[model samples]
Target: AHVITHYHRTIDKVTERFLGKRQIGTTGRGIGPTYADKINRVGIRIQDIFDENILRQKVEAALDQKNHLLVKVFNRRAIDADEVVESLLSFADRLRPMVADTGLEIHRALERGETVLFEAGQATMLDVDHGTYPFVTSSSATAGGAATGSGIGPGKLERIIGIVKAYTTRVGAGPFPTELFDESGEFLRANGFEFGTTTGRPRRCGWYDAPIARYTARVNGVTDFVLTKLDVLTGLSTIPVCVAYEVDGVRVDEVPVNQSDFHHAKPVYEEFPGWTEDITGARTFEDLPKNARDYVLAVEAMSGARISAIGVGPGRDAIVVRHDLLGAS
Candidate 1:
C-alpha cells in the first residue's frame, strides 16, 4: 500500500472504481491508501474498529485533514466525515474476532519452536531510506524491516534471505545503474514478465548489477540470496553483468553515497555466454544450463553473500538449491 500511493492520494478513489476490471491486473485492494493513513497516524486499526464512538472521532479528524488537502491542492470533491464514519462502522461485524495481539501470538509460537515465515513486500531497491531516494517506496521493504513490521525483536531475526532478480528491475522513478533502454531491455521485460505485482507498471529492466546486490546484502545483513527470474535469460547469444561502475573516471567497488556520482556512473560490464533452451524444472545445481551456472557463480562472487536458492521461474518448486539457509525440513 505504501509502495503504491506514496505520493498521490487519489489512488483509492481511482482504484476502487476499477474493482472488476482486468486492465490494471489488480483487484482494487485498499492497501496503499490504508498504509498512507498509517504513516499519517490517522489510520483506524482493528482495535479502533470495535469502538464506534472512538472510530467516529478518529475518522472525523482524518477526513478533516484529507478533505482540506483534496480541495486545496487537487481541486477534488470534499469528503463527508459522517458518511465515511457510517461506512466504516458497517464493517464492525466481520472485524471483531480478528483483532488481537499479533506480536504476542508470534512470541507464543516462537516459544514452542514453531518456524515462522515472515514474508516481506517489495524489494530492497524499493526501500525508502536505503534505496534510490524520493523515487522509492514509502516504507522499508528490505529484510531488516521484517523485525519491526512483524512486531518481533531484532534478536528473534536469525537470518535475512534476500530475494534478487537474475536481472535487475525497478518501477516508478529512480537511478537504475544497469537499465537497458534498447531491445535487450524489451526482451528481458517481455521474457521475464517484468511488471509490478502491485501496480502492474512495466519494470525498468537491466543486466544483473553486482555492486547494488553487494550493497543490499551488506545493508540488510542478508545471509543468503534467492535469485529469481533466471529462466528469462534463456536462448540468448550473450549475457552482460555489471561488475562495477565508473564514476568521474574512477572505479568504485560499492554504491556511492553521492547521488550525482551515481547518476553519472557508467556500468562496467562483464560478459558471459547465454544459455539456450530451458532449465526451469531443474532441481539440482548440475541440472542448470552451463552458462546459467556460470551466471549464478559470477553473481555469488560479487554479491558477498552465499547463493542459497535460485528461482528459475515463478513457481513454488521452480527454485534450484545450492543450500537452504532458512533450512529444509
Candidate 2:
C-alpha cells in the first residue's frame, strides 16, 4: 500500500526538474514517491493516522532524510512534520467509516458465490515490471496485479478481459512505433477525442499496433478483448494496422527484448478496407457493415484473443456482444 503527502508532490516536481530533458512523464501526483516510500519502509500507512504519536514519529523519521535531500541536494525548503501530521489527521474521521479488511470482505463474497470484478487503474503497457522500463507506471497494471492488490489468491482468478481502442493513442512521452505525425494522426485524434482524462492533454494518435496487442495478450493471459471506439474509424478510405515491426531493417513479429530496439522499431502495416456506415445504432454483430466486421475479425485473429464485445459508440448500451463476458471461457 502507498500513502501520499504534500512533500511527495514537491519531491516529484523537484526530482523531475533536476532530471531536465530525461524526466519520465509522470502525472506529478506523488504516486512514484509514495511507492518509493512504501518500498523504503518509510511510508505512512492509513492505520498510523488514528494514533497521533505513531503518525508524528513516522512523519518525523521520513522527513529527517527527505528534508535533507530537499534542502542540501535540491536546494528546496524542508517540509514540516507537524504540518504533514495535521493534514493527514484531518482525514481520519471521514476515512474511519470506509476503512475495512477489503481482502477478507472479498473472500467472504467469493465463498458466498458472489461475483467480484477487479478494475485496473492503468493499462498493461504502463505496468511497472512488465511494461516499457522507466516509462511505465509505479505498480503492476496486469491481471496478476488484480490478485496482489486485492489480496486474492492467483489461482482463484479467471477471465482477464483487455479493453483496447480501435486505433492506438498514447498520452505523455514514449516510443510509439505506429505514431502518426500527419493529417491521419490529427483526424484520429479529432474523431476519437484523444485527450487525457486527467491532464486534458492531446494524445499521440496512431494506427492500431497488433504486435503490442499480441504482446499484451501473452503477458496478461487475456481471455477476451473489448474493442472500443470502432465508430471513430468510420469514414477512412483504409485503416492501417501494424502487423509487425522492423528494427534495424530486420522484421520482428513481436515486441523487442531490448528497449533500444523497441524505440527504433518501425511499423509494418497491413491495410484494411474501411466502412462508411453509422454503427452507433447497431445492437448485434450482424447489424455491422461488411467492412467493419472484417476489420474486427482481422484484428481479433492477430490480437491472440477473441473480441467478446465491440463498442460502437460512447453510450452505455452502445455495444455489440459476440460472446458472454461472465459466462463464456
Candidate 3:
C-alpha cells in the first residue's frame, strides 16, 4: 500500500489553492498526491515503515523536490522530512501485525467455498480512467479495479452489484445534466440527507439519471442495482427522471463521447407520478404503493440492469429485495 506522508496533504492543499476556481474539490487528505508519488516511483510504502532507514531516504527524496516547489513556486513553508518519517513510523508496529498476503488468503477462501465481497469506495463516475477526466478521483472505481487492486484475476469475479441512489448526488465539481436548482433539489437534500460523510458539505442533487445508470451498467458489467432512497420522493407530486441528454440539439441516449459536450448537455426528462404513502415499513416488492412501484419499474426499464433491491427508507430493514444478489438472477 502507498503511504500518505504529511507533505502529500500539504502539496494537495497548496496545489488546490493554486488552482483557485479550477480546483477538483478533492478531500485534501493527500489522496491525489500520494498516487502521484506512487507513479513517480518515490512513494513511501507500507513495507518502508518496517525499515526506518529506507523510510527516511524515500521521504527525504520526495521532499527534496516538493520542498522546492513549496518554497519557490507556491511561496509556502517547506515540509520537514524528519517529521513525516516520524509520523509514519509511529504506526508501523500496529499495522505490521495486520498486514498479510490478502490475495492469497482470498484465493484460498474461494477454494474452500467461502464467499468474498469486494466493495469500492468511490462510484463509477469517479474512476480515473473511465469517469469524467480532470474532475475524477485518483484511482479506479470500477468492478475491474477490484481484481487488479486485490491481486486477483478478473475471471475470479462472479457478480457485480451496483448501489445507485433513487436520485443522483455528487460531492465534488463535475458536469451534472439533471441537477436541480429549485425547491425539489432542496427537498431531496433535506429528505435524503445528501451531505458528505466526512466533509459535511451539501451534495449536488439531481433526479434519477437513466443514461448514466446505463453507462455504468455497460462499463462495470453490473448484474444488479440496489436503488436507494426511494422514500425521499414520496411527497412530491411528480418525479422527473433523466432518460437522455439533449446535446447541441441531438438527443444522446448515453453519456456524451466528448467532455465539452457532456459539460453542456441538458437532460431530457421523463416524468413519473409520485406517491403519498410512507414506505419505511414495507419489506416486500408487493407491499410498496402502486405509484412507487410504477416509478421503480419505469426506472428499471430505463436503467440497463435489473433493480434487484429497493431502499424505501434509512433503516436497515427498510430494503425490499426483489432478487437475491448472491444467487443467480
TM, every model: 0.87, 0.98, 0.99
After superposition, which runs of candidate 2 have C-alpha atoms over 4 Å from their true positions?
Answer: none
Query: Tens digit of lDDT per residue, candidate 2, span 87-182?
Result: 999999989898899999999999998889999888888899988878888899988999889999988777899999999988767789999999
Q: For model 3, what is the C-alpha lDDT against the true structure?
A: 0.92
Which lDDT tens digits does candidate 1 get at residues 1-329?
A: 11222223464555445444423222245555667788878777766656889977887787777777677765678877677667667777886776678899999999999988898777786677887765555578887788878789988888788888889988766688899999999999999998888768898999999999999998898888888888999988999989999999999878988877888888999999999878888989899978899989988999989989988877899989888676742
Q: Model 2, 174: alpha-carbon shift in Å?
A: 1.5
Q: Is candidate 1 or candidate 2 better by lDDT?
A: 2
* Decreasing TM-score order of the candidates: 3, 2, 1
Q: What is the overall TM-score of model 3 with all chains considered together?
A: 0.99
lDDT-sorted candidate list, best first: 2, 3, 1
Residue pairs that clash (backbone atoms under 3 angstroms), model 2? none
- Report the C-alpha displacement of residue 115, candidate 3, in angstroms: 0.9
In candidate 3, stretches whose alpha carbon ends up further than 4 angstroms from where it belongs are none
For candidate 3, lDDT tens digit of each residue in 240-293?
999999998999989997999999999999999999999998999999999999
Deviation of model 3 at 304, angstroms: 0.7
